[model samples]
Target: MAHLALYRAWRPQTFQDMVGQQHIVQTLQNAIRENRLSHAYLFSGPRGTGKTTAAKVLAKAVNCERGPSQEPCNECPSCVRITAGTVMDVVEIDAASNRGVEEIRDIRDKVKYAPTEVRRKVYIIDEVHMLTTEAFNALLKTLEEPPAHVMFILATTESHKLPATIISRCQRFEFRRVPLEEQTARLREIAEQEGMNAEDPALAYIARLSDGGMRDAVSLLDQIASFAGGNVTLEQAIDATGGLPSEQFARLATAVRDGDVSAVLQEIDDMMKAGKSADKCLEQLMHYFRDMLLAQLAPDASSSSGRVADPSDLRQLAAGFPREKLFGIIDTLNRYQTEMKYAAHPQTMFEIALIKLCTASGETPSVQEGSAAGASAGGAQAGVSSGEVSKLQARLADMERKLEAALKGGGVAGGSTSGASASGGGRSSGVSQAPSKAPRVRVKLDPFVAAHDSPQSKELTAKWPQVLQRVKEERVTVHAWLVDGEPAAYADGTVLVAFRNTIHRETTERPANKAMIEGVLTSVLGKPAEMVTTMQKDWQEALASGAGASREEAAAGEELRLVPEDGTEPAREPIIEEALRLFGEELVVIKDD
Candidate 1:
């Protein structure tokens, strides 16, 4: 006989031999004993949870020569033939390969005939979700009302993809993943049966790596046993799986807690040089920290089976991490792990995440705000006193008051001290004068409004939702501010967005925010686009003031032209001329009040 893989060799032949799914086994056994079997059955769960195994066992139970018994007697010729797949009435179909309307139609045709070789003609369709829409429809009628001598069993890892109509016709049973302890015991049982020498921790580690899949755990144990020449150890298991030891993760965590970037990076570099994958390393590290967190939060609770570290060591490590810092670290690791899934250079992302953890404070704030006081107060560090923070806040409030007064008094066009002092009439000498706030630079909307009904403008309006979606994907904060704005007009490779809220308009006009929005627009619109923001009220006022005059007026020699009192154009300020020259006449307009 050829060598049999451990998974297949140890396949559960009876419900009594199966592990970690007692609920399903007991139910099926009672149903068979009482003769209350459904015509169609749907077994759904993660891989290696005994879906297919249960199906085969049920088939044998229903057709065993002794009787239609709850347990199939392997000695009986009927059970033997079914187990060997020599029985003509028992059919196992790989739906993934034969997922077609024709194949399902063939099954529909064949299901009507009586069983030729057994009491019940059993059909087991694995990965039944792979069947196409037409195939599912074809199988529906037959599955709902099969012949009295037939039973249909469908198995799939993903049950959500099955159509509602098909799902409604079957009796569904969800198989749960095997628990860690049960899986470990199964591995130990297999090791002892095969006369392999394996340490307890090595078997447990293999079980943990399998993530609750019995077949995967057994296969890994077999592979590691072969690699270790039949004597498996923890180190051998780790080496075979490319897994890092708990000690390495502890050292890395210590470096991060101590804010030692060099040590963290060096450790990562060494691991990478040893052929460890960045993503796998990150995943292990995340689990290690999770174990530590659990240890800290619930000191009385027993340790997780997957954690190989000693309880004392885990408690000691957990002591160094505060609850809040642990949360932030976990959150950062999770975010970076998600990004690394699509990253071309995952190692760089991994390194950056570690470096971030090294430098982050215990109470890492998600959003950072920079104030004038923080900028002016040089040498400010985390050790700054509460009194100092209060003083800075007071200073910021005073500056804001002065700015409000300056705006109300029409101080100046730019932040000019001389202009502010000259404009501060009847103000108290004790009150410091703030520099005038600069006038907002707005896009000249005459051309845009005239072409507001053009194809480009309409296209932008149609694709505005896509732009908002892309913005949300890039930075949700930007989207919160940009969502209030609408594409008011488009002209000359520029998009004019009008905002209803002043704060939203100002925030959307920030250089960084504007650049990100423009990038999203360019990608979605398939053209180079620039975004200019203005208040919605201002845009409406401009449209009302003849800015949106029909193009036919200009074509009929009725152009609206601006002229000075002396029959020549008025001279513009040097700054205004420069602005017009740089932004174009259609995007820059002088506003004097």
Candidate 2:
């Protein structure tokens, strides 16, 4: 307890000592000069960004021996005790610990008194957001009519939680998280003072890891210094942080750039074996990939020549990937992150991810392109071409076999191919298996179908309210999902019920289940849409077809639609029920809800 942590020891005692927030300091200083300070002030911002520090400094400045001056002469008994937090007049309270209404009431009662031993009574409440609403209301009235000798300095990391009415009564100052450049410079100064030789890149790395918080950066530096004999080398920094060296990540990125899945996988395995976390590695790669994507798609981030961090390695990887392939890889990684989030062993996630990423059609765009080149070369005929052409053609033909081998071999890129062709430069975008053609049987809806509205159709109508709107507006795409397709009727008398197949026999989809269908259908037709649904067979031939294929993508919604907005309907897969396809286009029309 005798030795303070570096963060505490280096705590800014005066406005001049604070970093990255001259604007806030200048305003506070001017306010003191003009004697325009508020009776109650709210200091709010991110942690380590000086909200508490600013509050304490402001308190010291106000109670300084020399009339409410900007600078607190630390030598004054009042200043010294306040700084030491030993003064009876300057009370520092952790609202987090004393948030009950009774505690607030005690403060309310005490506020009427003058300073106990200083010029003014300063009540500094840290984490004021923790105060209950009742506590806040009690304090609010007291604050609005505080003694002239009393000042309140309320600091909170989350100002949003404070009651707006309370906030409106106090002068508020927002502290922002420090910027990277500021953090980097501050870390450099700290390292210099410690007599440690820290590289610029290493310092930059720490600054970034700190996420624009000077205290965090200093703490990390202190950690690195203690663990690495007081000299924080870049390698030591990466080792301590499990941040894979930029060099190694760059190498892996290079392989990705070259469209080498095998190399990418090998690199991942090697990193994982080195005790670097697979999840962390994936996260780093994600960040790197994001930088690259920005560099690839945005002119502003294109070059280090123009920007601070070029994200070159990533840009190269992105450039090597086709647009579609890039998007696909991103999608796959997103899915992987979601699924493996809670997995106990993340290593397996990346172990499989590396394998998948290498041969992954999306991330492995270059590989596919190379494979296309090889396949084109191998298919070369009596009219075929040269050495490079043949090599590429050969690769194309054996891609699946090669990919399968890579997956089994921890993701090696260069496998000796017996079918090697002497070809190159024949790369294509993607090499997905051609989907066999399926007949398009366009079933048109009856012209009479308006925005359908019928009480019986209410259930189905309510199911996809968004889709109904889109269909009526003739939006680019729309597909009615068919979870259950059956006929049901209910209206004082008879109703017809039919299902597509035994599979569609679920009671939910069954028309016999009267509660499931009939809604706004009548609104569209001015009468009840006599609900009639029956399972129907595929009417196509050449190859005997059945009802619509399961997993039918709704074509009603526009392509590349946004992932559903918060609380909105999801772009879900259409259900595979028989009655749905039977009456697919002829289901009750839509009308206003």
TM-score of each: 0.68, 0.60
Q: What are the lDDT figures for the candidates, one per model? A: 0.77, 0.60
lDDT (Cα, tens digit) per residue for candidate 1, span 1-593: 11239888899999999999999999999999999999999999999899999999999999998878989997888999999999989999999999999999988999889998889999999999999999998998898788899899999999999999989999999999898889888889999999999998888787778777888888898888888999999999899878998889989999989888999999999999999999989988888888778778877765333354534468898998898888888899998888787666899999999999986752132112334443344124345566655544443444344445566887522233321222221111212212232332344557666767889999999999999988887677889999999899776566789999999988886656876797898899898776667788888998888565666552343412223335544454333343344335433333322
Backbone clashes under 3 angstroms, per model: 1, 57
Tens digits of per-residue lDDT for model 2, 1-593:
11237678678899988998999999999999998888999888887788888888888998888768887777888888888889888889999999999999999998887776888888989999999989998998888989899999999988999999999999988888787777778888877887888887777777777666777777788777776887788778777777877667667666755657778778877986788777777777666665556767773652322112346545555676566655666666766665466555677776666557665544334455567545543443333456635544443444445554566877423421110110111111112211122121122111112112335435444443542443233211111223334223222211233345545333333322322233333344344433333333321220133223321232232121112225343221121121123224222111100
Model 1 misplaced regions, further than 4 Å: 1-4, 305-313, 362-593
Best by lDDT: 1
User: How many residue pairs in model 1 have overlapping backbones?
Assistant: 1
Give all candidate RMSDs, comma-separated: 11.5, 15.8
Deviation in angstroms for 424 in model 2? 46
List candidate 2 stretches off by more than 4 Å: 1-4, 255-262, 294-335, 351-356, 360-593
How accurate locally is residue 449 in candidate 2, as Cα lDDT from 0 to 100?
20
